[model samples]
Target: MLASVGEIVVVRDGSGPEILLVHGGAGPRTTWGALAPLADRWTLAYVHRRGYPPSPPPQQRQDFEVDARDLAPLLAGRPHVVAHSYGVLGTLIAAAAAPGSVRSLTLIEPPLNYLVPDDPEVARLERIGDAALTHGMDMDPAELREFLRVAGAPIGDGPLPAGVVAGVRRAHGGRPTSEARPQLEAIRDVGVPVLVASGDHSAALERICDSLADALGGKRSVHPGAGHFVAAAPGFAEQLETFLHKSVR
Candidate 1:
């Protein structure tokens, strides 16, 4: 039987502590479902960001300001948490918001404002960044998702899944100008046992993860075969298990 989203504190029953799993843009809990095999050794809870997946929500520029504190009420307390990409943005915001609740965190590739590379030696890079940033603060949801996907990074020829691309339309526009600076500040202030990693291939990913690890007193792991998706790398589960085992005490 599956555990109820609200039944577990922090999220679900992991081997060491609780793990709250948050997904990136246009993704669903199924995004993490692939990792369910890890559930045998660890309790995992996958969050759908409320209105995402099959739910309906307002189209507005929202902030990760609420973090897991929004999930806290449901989880009862903060447990060890893990977030990826943009999901890490809010997870970090939450940890900073309610330090008492979280035990430890493993954040892989949280996108900070600076990760958006500005120097694109190639014209395509420049164009990608320009289109992605689009005034640096628009309320257009599609543009926002598109920017994140292509900004500072190569636009892979791979076609984005229709469901994934369509998911952006569900969100309210891009980052709010007033909120961006402060949000960045909050992530900078998070002082806790944390792990930050990125793929070796991503310039911005490597740079930002390094900066975050340095600032937050975190361990940096550069997955050799991975890029932005470090958590999906081979042996990531074992690495995480080792980290969690040591961290639980």
Candidate 2:
């Protein structure tokens, strides 16, 4: 069913315990479509973050702080929260605020580079992201492509889709991921079982994920082959299901 969690639009389907699925720059379907089949066993709440259609856009740009405010009220049920890419920033903030309300937290390739800020590769990735968001569509084609590549956006070699372009535009001038300093200690103290997964496609991302896992005292898994779309990687559903099964509240 379609419902509103505060101002955010949410599509909830299936049965059993809820698993909130938060997408990053990509839409819900792009991020979680591969896991739709899991609805047979678990309810999936696909959050339509601000700047996405059906959900109202943010008052400013696509800032994670706005997302955190939007997501805080939705955590009442202690759902297993799964967030990807940029969405992870806000989700982390929300979860940290009410750590006991989260059953388990799974993060996919979030650009929380501050955890490993000294790494040259992480710095490179951060620079590319800043450039892309700063320039948006005005960025040089090659630079934009490089940004998209690091972001795991599946633009391929074809002309950019209108939806994709719009998503990029919405991201223009958004808060940089490095600026997100979620209360990791607060979350860790609550003893939430956190799982940080990476695609193993980028060394920089892997390094960041490693630090995140360590800081959160969470298990880290690398699901190769899907690049940035780690949720769609082969055998990922099974692994996630296993984790969820063990994590159920």
Candidate 3:
């Protein structure tokens, strides 16, 4: 059934302990299809993301917090949350806006770059983003996509659900963008039990996740052979569930 809060496409179902899945960047709900099997055993809420297809029309509040706010009410009494990329940013903001709404958080390559300025890679990222904008996305979306993959944005050749791919094209606007500065600042103050992780292949992800761990005082993990989207990697769900249940202590 559709969730009462956020975009109309927001949905929650399943039984047992609850887990909210939020996709990073413009990827919509189905981006979690590989991980959806977990929902069968655990109550699941796969947020459709504001402004995306299957969601209500977009409002003016494109800022990260507004996106985060839309998902807040869904947490009515939910406990655990799992978010990736931009979704991680929103989840963190949501939990802060209403700390009572969430119990624990698992962030997969959150792009919270508070101290990432010094890295030469960050410089290259800005360059790549600019080039992507100039090159026109579809000209070769794969090039830019791979950049994000290295930066923890997850890139794959598998075609996404049609509506989901369309939603990403609309919401992401074809760029390997940086985190919104204000939102980055807000994350530094989030007080919660968060497990921040990055793939061993993602250097930029490692940098930001390390910064996040330092600021939030959270534990960290690294998935081998995975880029930004660990959920897309084989065996990721098992690792996440194990971490969520045991080491999150």
Candidate 4:
């Protein structure tokens, strides 16, 4: 069923405990398709984030502050929150604002370069991401390819498909990751169970995840092979299930 909360379209599925699945730049299916089997044991509320179809486009550039506003209402009833990529910025903000309102948090490969500001490698990736999101369709082929690689876009990539092009267009002018500074202390202070996971493909990303894990006093896991899309990597679903079970309050 579709539920409209703060203009966000949530597609609910399965039954059992609830998990609010927030998609990032690539949209919901690409972000969480690998977790489909988990719906058998848990209710999954798939959120179509702003700028994606079904959900209205953002008023201006896609900003996490706007996303936090959209997501705040969905946190009601304390559903376990699982957000990927760009979506994690807003999730972290909302969770920090009202820590007790979330059952748990599982963040996968969030581009939280601010978490490791001193890491030049992380800074390099952040610059590339910012340029890609800001320029979007205007990006040159080489630059676009690099962005797709970092984003784990599933494409064999001869010529870009219309759908992929559209996705890129939607991401145009998105707020940069360098601007994301979620209140890690607030989440930590409230003792929210948090899991920060990343693919072992990029040492820079793993560094950011490691730093975020330390800041939030959370567990960290590396599920390699999927690059930025760690959710699709082998053993990810099982590990996520176990983490969710252990996080139950």
Candidate 5:
């Protein structure tokens, strides 16, 4: 059966403890591949954020708060949340706005820029992100390439993938409504079990992940050889499974 949270597509699979899997700019399919393995332990609810196909086009401007609002109702049961990239921003917001709405939070390289604003590496990333948001869908190819690189796309010498470019365009317009510091404070106060994970690559992302972990008083893990896409890294699923077991017990 098809279900939606305010026009955002929600796909569910398996039968077990509920786990909400929120995808980033890459959309729901980014989490689809993990369903089969996780389904044994988790009933997964994969969210297709607004602007992604099959979901409604973005409503007005695309603030992270908008995404958080869409997610609030879905967290009625305090499901465990595993979010990546931009999705992580929304998940944090929702968790903060509705205390106890999130049983546990597993963040995969969340781009919470405000977490480490003073870091030189983070400042460089802010410049790239600002450029992408400014250009929106009209971003030039060169700028897109750089943005993808800074955002941790594994794009090598080849041209940027059309799908990835499209996803970036879809997500580039909005600014975050709330800053990370306050959200972190709220989540910390709520006493949610938070786990911040990032790939060993991407210096900027690693730093942001570390700072966020510190702020939330959460555990931190760095996946070797994984760039921004830590979810797909080797042994990621196992590590996550272990964390889930330990966190809930």
Candidate 6:
């Protein structure tokens, strides 16, 4: 079935314990390809966050709080929540606001900068990200390709797909949300299971995942040879299934 929460679009499929899959800037369709295999075992709610296509554009510039508010009602019955990249920010906020609204959390390569703000590697990434946010679409072709590579496209030496470039451009305009540190304590207090996973490729992301795991008292997993797109990796579904079945707190 399909539903709309404010301007957000949610598509549901399968039948079992509810699992809300929130995609990052790439939109809900990005998760459809990688996570379709789980539909047999999970009643999945895939959210297309505001500003993404099919979801109406924001009335004004919206941040993570806007997303969290939109997601709260969907969390009814305490569904197991999984989010990737920027989607993780809103998921964390929603889980914190409604303390027991989430049965468990599986975050993959969430760019939670506040977790390790002082780390040098994170600082370097921050600089790169800041630059991209400021000049991504304006960047030269070569520069944009490098940016895409650093951002984890998992593509070969060929030209990037047009859709990928367009997605990045659309995402570059997003406003920054408030720091996530304040919500960490509340999320931890909720006492639900949390699993933080990241790819082994980026040093900064690894550190961020480590710190996020420590904050939530959650287990951590690293997908070999994977980058930001860890969900598309070969064993990702297996790992998620294992965690969901055996790691409930």
Q: What is candidate 1's local distance difference test score?
A: 0.55
Arranged by lDDT, best first = 2, 4, 6, 5, 3, 1
Which portions of model 1 show Cα errors greater than 4 Å? Answer: 1-16, 54-59, 66-69, 115-161, 176-191
Q: What are the lDDT scores of the predictions, listed in order?
A: 0.55, 0.89, 0.64, 0.88, 0.77, 0.77
- Tell me the tens digit of each residue's lDDT in model 4 across 16-74: 99999998888888889999999899999999988777888888889999999999999
Arrange candidates, best TM-score first. Answer: 2, 4, 5, 6, 3, 1
lDDT head-to-head 1 vs 4, winner: 4
Give the local distance difference test score of model 5: 0.77
10 residues in a row with least lDDT, candidate 3: 167-176
Model 5 off-target regions past 4 Å? 137-143, 176-182
Clash count, predicted structure 4:
0
Clash count, predicted structure 6: 0
Candidate 4: Cα lDDT at 1? 81
Which residue runs of candidate 3 sit more than 4 Å off their true CA positions?
26-30, 60-62, 126-168, 172-191, 247-249
Best by lDDT: 2
Deviating ranges (above 4 Å) for candidate 4: 155-157
Per-residue lDDT over 1-249 for candidate 1, one digit per residue giving the tens place of the 0 to 100 score: 234353222235346445777775535343454466777766676666645633334244434554344555533555667787656766766666566566677887665645444534223333433443234334344554455553222344575456544454444354432232223344445555677766676565566677777767777776655445566667676677677777653
Predicted candidate 6 versus true structure: per-residue lDDT over 2-38, tens digit per residue? 8887668898898888889988766676654677878
Error of 4 at 96 (Å): 0.6
Select the stronger candidate by TM-score from 5 and 6.
5
Q: Write the per-residue lDDT of candidate 5 for residues 1-249, one digit (tens) a residue.
A: 358777788888888888888887676665447445788768888888887767788877566777888899999987888999878888888888885777889998887777886788787676667667667657677766777876666577886677666656676767742244346788898688988988787788889889999999999988866567678788788888888887772
